[model samples]
Every structure is written in C-alpha cells, then in structure tokens.
Target chain A: MFNPTWAMTIEMVIAGVSVIGLFAALGLVLVLMERRVAAWMQIRLGPNRVGPKGMLQSLADTVKLLVKEGMTPDGSDKFLFNLAPYIAMMVAMLLMAPIAFAKDFRLWDMNIGVLYITAISSIMVISILMAGWASNNKYSLMGAMRSGAQIVSYELSAGLSILTIVVLTGSLNITDIINAQADGWWIFKGHIPVLISFVIFIIAVTAETNRAPFDLAEAESELTAGFHTEYSGMKFALFFLAEYINVFIVCAIGATLFLGGWMPFHIGNWEAFNHVMDYIPSSIWFFGKTFFLIFVIMWFRWTFPRLRIDQLLNLEWKYLLPISMFNLLLVTAIAILKWHF
Target chain B: MSGSTIIFYLLAAITLVSAVLAVTTRMIFRAAIYLLFSLIGIAGIYFWLNYEFIAAVQIVVYVGGIVVLIIFSIFLTQQAGEQLPKQKMGRQLFSALAAFCGLALVMLQLAQHEFTGTGNKAVEPTVANIGYQMLGVDDNGYALPFEVVSILLLAALIGCIVIALKSKPEKA
Candidate 1:
C-alpha cells in the first residue's frame, strides 16, 4: 500500500489531468453537437467532409487555431489582452469542482456548493469586460458593455430560481440537493412553483451565458464578433471553448437540481422499475440528463430569433425577475409547510 | 512552514501588493484590475480561514458586483488607455501622511490586542450557523441590524430610481 500523502498527491495529479482532458473533449463534442443541431434545424449537411460524418472537424479546427498566429493589436494592452483568455478558461474550470458527476463523485464537495457556483460564475463577466477593453476596438467595447449589462441583470433571476431549489432542499450543498430528489425530482414533485422556477432558470441562464435570443453581446450582424473581435488563433478558441464548457456546467447544475441528477425516474411502489433503473450506471444517468438539458438549450438557440438588447433587458427586469421573486416566496412557503413529497 | 501557512502568506502578499498597485497605478483601468485582484486575494484569505460562505459572498458582492460597476462607469467616463494626470506635490504629501497615520493606528491596535487563536475550538463557519446568527432574535443575534441594513438598501434603491427618472420634457 502506498503512503497516504503520496496516494493523495497522485490522485490530485490524475484529477488535474483528467479535468484538462475533459475540457478538450467537451469543447470538441459540444461544438460538433451544436453544429449538427443547427444544421438539422436549417436543413443542411453540417461538416461532412472533415472526417467520418465530421467526427474530426472540431479537431481539425483545433489544429488550425493552434498553428495560427495570435496577434496582439498595436494599441491594445498586451498584458491584459493575453491574460483575459486564461481568466475565462480558469473560471470555467473552477466551476467544474462542486458539480457531482456521479454518486459520491465530485472534486470538492463543499457545503456552499450552489453558492460557490453562483459566486464563481459571476466573475465570468469580468473576463469578458477585460477582453473587450484590452482589444482596444469599438465593437469589442460595445460587446463587453452589452454583456456586462446582460449578465448582471440576468444573474438576479437565475440566482432567485436557484434559491427556489435551495429553499426546497433547505441546503445549499449540491449533493444534498440531488439526494433530496431521490424520491422524485423537484420539477415533478414541487409542483407549479418548481416548474416555474425551472423555466425561469433556463431563460435566465441562457441570457447569463450569452446564448441565443440573449446574445446581444456578440450580435454578429451588429457588433462584428463582439468582445473577442480582436482575438484570433488559440486565444479566440479559448473563449469559444469556455462558452461551451460553461453551458455544460450550468446544464449539469440544472440537472442536479431539477432532474434527479444521477437518480433514475421511478414511480412510488414500483419496486421493479426502480430496481431496473439501479442497474444502469449512475454516471450514465447523470450524463444522460445533462446532455438532454444541453440539447434543449441548443434547441432554444436554433429555434428562437435573437432579441433586441432593450427587449432582452425588459424581459429580465420586467418579467422574469418579478416572476422568479414571487416563485421564491411560493417555494419557501411550500418548503415550510412540508408540501413536497 | 506547512502548506496552509504558506498559502496564507502567499494570499496576504497578493492582497497587499495588489492593493498598493490599485492605489498607485497611473492607468485608471489597470488600477481597477488591480483592485479586482486585491478583492479576490482578500476572498482567498477568507477561504484560508475556512469562512467559505463569507469568501463566496465577498467575491460575489465586491469582485463581481462592485468592481464590474466601477469598470463600467470608468469605460463610460474615462479614456481607459490614457494615464491619469500626476498628482500635485501637496496633495500627494497630504495623502501620504493620511495613509501613514491610518497604518500607524492599525499597527497600534494590533500591538495592543491579545489574539487568542481559537484553533480547534473555533465554531464551524457553515452557512446555517451564519444564517441563524444573522436572523436570530437572541442577544448574540444581529437581526435588528440586518433588518435596518435591508431598509437602508431599499431606501438607496428608491433614491437611485428617483434620481434616474427623467423629468417631463419641456413643451417646445
């Protein structure tokens, strides 16, 4: 048997490497999935020539980005220009820690799991702002400012919706939240309030991540390429990769809270059905739920038209925020009355 | 030093150095970035103290909210790429004296206080404990102060809305 200290060191090293690998894999798979989804919606063949059914398209893109020169504009802040992508990547990676992938499998299961995610995710806006400012481009600055306003506003509803779950669970820990849903998922059991919050959560997080219908920050027709307008090569790729990874993280968190996470669907007194669910690996269940959420988000991206910036803010401030706040009160009352099964 | 102690010192160094840079930097945008780093470092210190909830709040409220607002305003009002004008000699000297006096006062307090480290006996800094402490009605609770703060924030929000409301355009 190895010494405990050495074993821990090895474990940490392995975990670090795996996380990096996961980042790369996620970036490749999500990008391909998004393209394929978009293509199907638009009725076109997407990226069929690269490899077998375009399986290696993202890899080829990665290689191209790696070799391309990452140029710093003459007037740009060199230090900050270089630092912004790393910050974006770092925030994305930090968010991965508290997320439980499978039963009892998480990097850091801190007590403030949900809170930590919210807090760290908030910092993502800064990196966008930094990237925009450092690029020294008008379009970049405009994109950054739009993103700043968009994220700050949407964070409220997203946070309130997350709190609905927190109130229902009576705990902020992700593990406890997931475990609480073992009997039945919050979306099904907590009734209308939970359903309302889940819908609000999806919309808010879509805005928060700068996804479609809320992607005023990077409106291609208006702002060129937005905040990363000046970035090219691998530097731009980092921001691109970070965006997908963030979507995955948020979807994972949403799955953990609203869906049963790794917990399989079961009806009360259906012992045989529950036993059959148990046979499927917890990791598969977790990933299955998470991917479904991801696919739904992509569906939103393809189905909806991007909102005007003013309409976007109005949607959050006028509609979603108030609804979510009221939903919180409703959820809190239900929790107190022990109304949920 | 052990790992934790080393980590603490590293965090302290980062906080102090960034704080100094924040105040001393010539570029206003760089100053804001430094301030962001200093705030993050302080959050790191809170994490080192095992006050995870407090640390997260610090990052969320200060690093995320306040700093972003500051940067946004700077973007609107200032030419971020340009260096700020150099301070006049008298103003610099006066500010130096004020800073030195503040430092001395803090040092004096540090020298006088007896820091009895609770070590193993320290209360766990969990979110539940903090929630109860803040909302509890007993003598040790801060419920009254908390309510007052909420009221104060509500008033501030109202004041902002009032100030921001556009007056009816004069009939031309």
Candidate 2:
C-alpha cells in the first residue's frame, strides 16, 4: 500500500544524494576559502603544499578527522551526545529543499515557502542545546545558552524583514516571489525601502546562522570550541557541514527574495537586452548572487569581533526588532503609495 | 490502507511513544530530550497536513526556541548529571489512570461526532487561504487574533526575562 509518485521518488533520491555531495564539496571549498581569506587578511600564504595551493587539504583533514577517536566525557548524557550532531545536520539539509536554485528548480514549491524557510532554519538552536547538555561541560553549556539567546532574539527581526518581502511580492512561494521580481528586482523596484529591508535581512540572517562576530555560541577564546567542545571526528564534521550549508541557504533565500532569482538586470524598454539577460541560466545567476552574500558574511566573520551575549540580545530586541518593524511599516507605505521608480 | 494512511499511523505511533516518554521519563533532562523528539514528530504531522509553514514554526518555536530555553534552565539550575527522583508509585498510578480516562473520553466524543465542513466535505488547510484569512483580506479576517498573538509572545518574552533575572542574594 506504500506508493509515492515516481517523479517525486526520483527527485527526492537525486536531491538527497546531490545535497550530501554538496555538503562535502561546500565544506572542503569553504575551509580552503577561509584559510585563504585569513591568510590574505594577515599577509601569509595559506596551506600551499597539499596538492597545489592546498586544494586537497580539506580531503586530508577529513581523513584525519575520520581516523580520530570521538570522546564521551564521564557523566555525559550519552544518548543525546550522539544524537545532537545528526539533528543539526538533518535540519540544515532540510532547509535547502525549498530554495529556487534556478527558474524552476526546487524540491517543493509550497505556497508558504518564505515562512517555512524562516521556521525550519531556527531548529539549529535545539541541536546546539542538545550538544551542550550532553557534553557535560560548563563551557559547552554556556556557549549553547548564548546561542539559544542569539537565535531567539534575532528570529523576531528576521521574521519581520521576511514579512516585508511577503508584503511587497504579495506571495509566500519562493517561485512566486522570484516571479514578482521579473520586471525589476525588489532591491531596485522598492528602492530605498528595499535597501533598508535588505540590510536588515542580512544582519538578522547573520545572527540567525551564528556566523562569526555574532558567533558567541562557539567562540574559541571564551568557550573553547563552545557547544561542540567535546565532539570530534566525523561527528564534529557534521556540525561544520551544517554551518556552511546554513550559510548557503540563508544567502540563497536573501538573493531570491531581494535581488532577482533567475531574472537578470535590465532597464525598462530594453526587450532585446532583457532577453539576452535570460540566456545566462538561472542557477548560475542564483549561485552568483548567493555566493556574493556568503562572501559578505565570511568577511563579517573575519573582520568583526564577537559581541557579548547581553549586547547581542539588546541589539535584537531594542534595535534590530524595532527598526525592522518600522521598516516593514515604511515598505508597506511605499507599496501602497505605488512609489516604484 | 492507502500509503498516506499507513505512513500517518506509523508517525502517530512514534509521536505518542515519544510524548509518553517525555512525561514519564525519570531523568528530567532525558524527559526534555524526549519532549524534543515528540515535538518533531508533531511537526512531521504538520508536514503531512501540507501545512509546511506550521511544521516549520513547530520546529523553530517549540523545538528550537522553547526546548533550548528549557535545557538552558536545566543547566542554570546546576542539576546536571543527577537523575531526578522517580515519582511515588501511588502518584504514578493515579496519573496513568487519569490519562487513560482522558483518552477514553476524547475517543468517545470523537466517535459520536461526525462534523463536516461547509458542503458535506472537509476543507484542506491551504497556506494561501489561511494567510488571506489571517490578514482579514478575504472573508472574516483574523487580524485581531493575529495581533493578539504578538502580544502573547511579548508577554512570554517578559515572563522569561523576569524569571531568569530574579535572584537570591549570593551566600555570605
């Protein structure tokens, strides 16, 4: 009696396998990117020996991690300790399913795609907490607590900013949102308001994903590897994979919602130019926009120091939340006023 | 049974088992973790309903935010590595009986009732329709309730802060 559509089954299998591949590929590339970026910022050559400019360095590191033994601290909650990393990895993978990679590429084009994305993205907090509790380490616990606060606080503004996009597009589907930007992307069409919303979205997502500067949860100096302090081997790699995948998903959402999805740039009354814009393949454009945002996030990570937990909460509740709320009001006003340029 | 029905039953069993464990587990921390699993199962049910938004909210708010908060509180209490004392036998028996009776009552009520949606049919919950109704743009808008929920969330935030901040003076 068990039946699923053949197409759906095939798509699910393909998507699952591809994402696993993507996770590994992205992890390796981001590690290299991080090393190179760090080196450039500090005037040094990042890993150069491991297979030409350290291209195979991540592979070697992966093998090293695989061979290393995982430790379970005495008095740790053993069940949760093992389960936590998988939960983190699973939720992150789930978020990627709804994103419109190209014009028509997505796992599920549910009507409430935008809201769903926001909702599922936050589950990382629970996994972090589980890891912290299971680790039986004070530092890990503290890191988890800070991360919990960070995610919950930032979610308010992130939700509000996303609501602004929903209002502008008048649709919740990512595909529909992309289609709304067919003529002109929200960034250009909504003008100043879109810029404001875009900035809010970027900051809120950065906090949400626990990237650096806002990464109080895993601060190396203070928490000593933070929530994953006790984790090692492939288990630790799972958390690492989840983090980068999350970065990619959030950036893709930002690109799809604010900039055009597959739609390319063109001024009005230029049909021929716009047609040419369409030829550059949607996935390429989508990835380009997404990577640019990821680069920005990585830049923020390297440049800014971590914020104190209290300051992080205050930034969200007092500043980001209120500003995003008012920005939503402003965006609504402009949309109603038909102030498109 | 159809595939969806079979899947539903399986998921329901998992949900019920996890939920029971969540409450009945002797270890307070383990109970919390079980509660997390129970909540995730509930989200799975939401996905089955095609209310992807609600499912995600279920994960984000309940599993992610609330469970994390509860775990943090557990840590802050400094009760890690200690098993919570088991409930008294008599109390456990009474609780189990009460739960069984409650379930029986609900089943009885459900069996007797055969409510139908507007045209002798059931309405599938669609996000678009729900969103429209929420904003009061079409039909009777639930705008007031939507706004009230924000107030409810604000109260929750204040309450959490108040509870977390309240402190006994440090021991001399």
Candidate 3:
C-alpha cells in the first residue's frame, strides 16, 4: 500500500501547492477587482491609496484578517462550527482538479468532468448549513435554509443548461468539450435555442454561486453576514476566499463550455485574423475569456438589485427550469439533425 | 495491498463509519452531514470501479438532491441543538440484528462466488457510449429503463406539486 513512487509523490506535492496557490491568487485579485468595479459603477473612485491604484488592497485586507482574533461564540457547536469553513474550502479545492486550465494542462482529467464539478459544488450547501446551524443564531439558520433551497433548486436548471452543450458535443470530458468548440463556439452554432441556453447557463451559475441578484443567502440588510454570522478572523476569511474562488471556477467553466476554452477566436475564411489570434498564448486566451465572464458577473452584482427569496425560487422553478428543459430538447433535435454550424 | 485495493478499503471505512454515525448521532444536523459523507464515499467507490457516469449520478442525485432535502426537513422539524430521545433497547437490538444479518449474507455470497470478469478489461467510461447505450436499438440498449426513469421522475414532480399546493380557505 505504501509503494508510492518518487515521481508520483513529487507530482502530488506540486499539484497540492499549485491548487492552494491558485486559490490564494484568485481570492486576492477577484475581491480587489470587485470592489473597484463596484466603485466605478457607483461613480466613485475606488481604493487608490493602497499599492498602485489599490492593487494590493486585498493583500492588506488579508493581513488584517490574519491578525484578527478567531472567535467561536458561546453556546455554538464547537466541532461543526469550526469545521464548516474548511469543508467549503476543501470542496472548492477538490473541484479544481477536473477543470482544464489550458490545452493538456489539468490536475486530473476525469471522464465525467462536468458532472464531477456539479456534484462536488453541491457539498457547499451542506457546509453552509453546518455553519448556519452550528452558530446557534436564528438569522444564520434562516440564511442557511434559504441558501440550501436556492442552490438545490437552481442546480436543476444549471445541469440542464450544461446538458444543452453536452448534447451538442456528445461528451462530458472537459477537454473534449473544449475541442468540440474549436470549429465554432456553442454560443453561436446551436442558433436560437443555444443562445437561450447560454443565457440560462449564465444566470443559473450566478445563482448557484450565491451572487447577486440571487444572493438571498447573504442579504446584508436582513441577515448580518448570513451563514457565517458567528465566524471571525481566519474562519471568516476562508469563507470569503471560497466565495471568490467559486466565482473564478464557475466563470472558468462558463468560458470553457460556452466560449472556447483556450482556443483563439477565429472566423470562417479569415486567415489573417485567425493567425493573429493564434499569436497570443493559449493560457492567456483561457484567462482572458474567464476574466471577461467574471466581469460580466460582477456587472450583474452592481447593476441588478438583490432578488427576494420567493422571486429567486420563482425565477429558477418557473422560468429557468422549463426554458432550459425546452432548450435541451431543441439541442437534442439539432444534434440529431446535424443542423448546428 | 495493491494501490487500488488500499483505496477501496479507505472508501469502505469512510462509508461504513459515517453511515454508522449517521444513524447513531444525537444531533439531527450532524447525522445529516454524516449521511452526506457516507453517500459521497459510496460515490468514490463507484469511481474506483470505473463507473464514472454512475458515480457522478450518485453524487448529483443523492448528495446534491436528496441529502439537501433531508437537511432542509431537519431544519424545519427540529431545532439545531435539540436531540431525539434514545431508541428503546429492544428496537435498537432488533435494528442491529437486521443490519448484521444483511451484511453477513452479502459477505457470504461474495465469498462463495467466483466472479468471472469479461477478460478483466477496464471499460472506458465515456459519455458517448453511455448515451448510445441509453438510446440504442440493440439488445443491450436500456431504452426501456431510461424511459421508465423519466416517467418516474415526472410522477415524483407531480406528487410534490400536489402535496405542496394547499387550497386556500373559503372566504368568511
């Protein structure tokens, strides 16, 4: 059982470091970026006093979070209350393994990549519930309940929307999904139904990650700090980091599925433009597309007001579910008919 | 002591231990969390057996859907710190006996059988093959079962709607 080879051991260590490093970088950058974006949208100059245009503001915030005393409230369930943030963080980290970063670069390219991501992401709900209930705070419990319901229901539309692309490509492998988009992105090729599914995908994923306008889980005005109400210091920081990491990961998935994964943009019979697009590195294309989607999500956060709990469920169950289901059928027929470009 | 065998034992331990705790734990919420861990461990075993699609399906449906629902109901019916009364000694003994007998029977059957795998070939669990098998017209196709599942899900959806839609009281 202990016959681990030197190469495999080294690989595991390297991968472990990279995943943690990536999470740290993504958390720091995305949080700072969000604040700046929010400021700009509100017609105010965001934090420009920190390092160069407040670029290192997240670094300062991290230090503050680190220095603050971590506290567990009285009457809280000690074990579960402490364990919840790590559960959230671990789920997100495990999910990173199956995602394709650039061509031929992934931690683990499982056969059922999309499904694995969806499955693992669901654990976040349990962790939130744990945090909420263990805190022994009524508001925390309410927020957790809301989040659990919202995530579980929204998962249906998210899966269905993703199934639309899976129908087109005929594969669940992340790399295969990317390869299928080489000729044409799913957003453009499947025509009307595909376009509609793309919209549903974006909206569903936003809600799944608990971002606005679907962030009923953390309505600051109603429930202070939501599920992590009793958390402080590193524990709360972990939750915050997980939220941003989730945003990065979901946006990355969106980029890979709907937009082309690391493929350079190209048009039919546009040789010169395609060649120019190819000059840029594949990883840059991947990150660029991912960040663009992240910006779109952040824009939604700043623009749309928070959705009420009933309205959130109504949007998912009444609107997104049926529409995505219909779109799935259309994509199925189109795939069978060879109608997609 | 091979790598795969070791992994299997780890998964089995996780599944068994958490499953036991799920039934035995006093805290309602912790029991639900333990059940989630057990289901996830079973999903891991499915992955080890190269049933990747089935593994993911188990996770998505059981962990994602059912366990969440269970936790939701727990929140609705029970307070966070409130504990259920201990089971009666006779009932607990009966349940333990039932579980032990089931495990023993399964183990005995497994030990008695000489399972002849199809040349020990590891089937590549690809989505296209699964899709084809689901919709294929061949004898091995699962078109009937697939359709049956869809109908079953439809029924479940309708049942939930009927249960949830409460009629308004007559106006005074």
DockQ of all candidates, in order? 0.57, 0.52, 0.60
Candidate 2: misplaced stretches above 4 Å? A1-9, B115-128, B135-172
Q: Could you give candidate 3's per-residue lDDT for residues B42-100 as a string of tens digits? A: 99999889887898899888988888889888889987777889999999999999999
Per-residue alpha-carbon lDDT of model 3 for A1-341, expressed as tens digits?
A: 33564555677899999999999899888999999999999999998888998999999999999999999999888889999999999999988988888878999988889888888888889899899999999999988989988888888998898898888988888988888877667788779998898789889889988898888888788998789889999999999999999999989998889888897786655788888888998899999999999999999999998988988889988999999988899899999999998
Which of 1 and 2 is the better model by lDDT? 1
Q: Which has the greatest lDDT?
A: 1
In TM-score terms, candidate 1 sits at: 0.97
**lDDT of each residue in A248-341, candidate 1, tens digit only:** 9999999999997888886655788888888999999999999999999999999999999899989999999999998999999999999887
Candidate 2, residue B150: CA error in Å?
6.4
- In model 1, pairs of residues that clash are none
Candidate with more favorable, higher DockQ: 2 or 3: 3
Please name the candidate that would achieve the greatest DockQ relative to the true structure.
3
Give, for candidate 1 chain B, the lowest lDDT window spanning 10 residues: B1-10
Give RMSD (Å) of candidate 3 vs. truth.
2.2
